[model samples]
Target: MTFYAFAKRIVSPILKKMYRVEVKGLEHFPEQGGVLLCSNHIDNMDPPILGVTCPRPISFMAKAELFNVPILSGIIKKLNAFPVKRGGNDREALRTGLKVLKEGKVLGLFPEGTRSKTGKLGKGLAGAGYFALRTNAQVIPCAIIGSYRIFQKVKVIYGKPIDMSELREKKASPEEATNLIMTHIQQLLNENR
Candidate 1:
């Protein structure tokens, strides 16, 4: 079995039981096609929670440092995560992300670019916007709340897909696109209040 299949069948149950994960708006995820799933970063747990919550298989860009760790590399690679340099634009990582989308797979990203130690959303970095502009991939804005603590009742709300067709003809600055997507994510978080 594929790693995702293995995880979905085995690890998924454990995640759901352990965290009591509650997924809302699951219908929002498109049944098929390239999709960019953007979420507010709250903790290191967000990605795996999302992977288990999402109906489709999601690939991610993890920090390059994780890949170098003893034994963690095999596990992350098995989970469909590739390595990306932290704290800056990793050109190769960005390209790999684009390739995942072009191949019609779901690419999961934290537009805030890093875990929010303060438990508040951070301003989005440019990588998400760059990918959205280049591939025109449908963007799914999501918010994960109450995941900073283990075994907490975590909730994941998926907003409707954001379309970027308005920029199909015009060139959009990466910063502009990044804010646009982040705004949607922030809105989703606001509603949870």
Candidate 2:
């Protein structure tokens, strides 16, 4: 099996058991096509939780610092995680993300760009919106509920793709697109929380 599949198979049950993870609304996910998967960032485990629960493999843009760690760097690379420089525009990272989507793959990203200490959703950065507008890929907004406290119920909710036809027609800016993405995520949080 591929590394992603292998890793998920080994880790999924462990994580599910450890956190009592409950994944909902997975039926909203598409079976094929490029997808820009956007989610709210709460904890570092958020990505892994989403990855395990998702039916498809997701190429994620992680903070560049994590790549500095030798063992973690190698592991995350194998897991299809790329490094992104936070607090500034990283052209290389942006290009990588575009390439993933153009190649008809799922590009997972945290719209807020960083973990929220308050466990509340934050305003989204333009990166998620940029991907949504630049590619033909559908934008799927997800919400990760509950802290990663051991034995606590952690839920991952995948919402339906945000309709971007109107935004595309208007040539909406990245900021505008991000607004819609964040709005859907917030709605999901409100509904699911």
Best by lDDT: 2
lDDT of 1 by residue, 48-138 (tens): 8898889899999888989989798999998899999988778899889999999999999998878898878899998988988999678
Return the number of clashes found in candidate 1: 0
TM for candidate 2 is 0.99
Off by over 4 Å in 2: none
TM per prediction: 0.95, 0.99
Put down candidate 2 lDDT per residue, 78-97, tens digits, no spaces.
99999999999999999999
Clashing pairs in 2: none
TM-score of model 1 (CA atoms): 0.95
Best by TM-score: 2
Off by over 4 Å in 1: 147-151
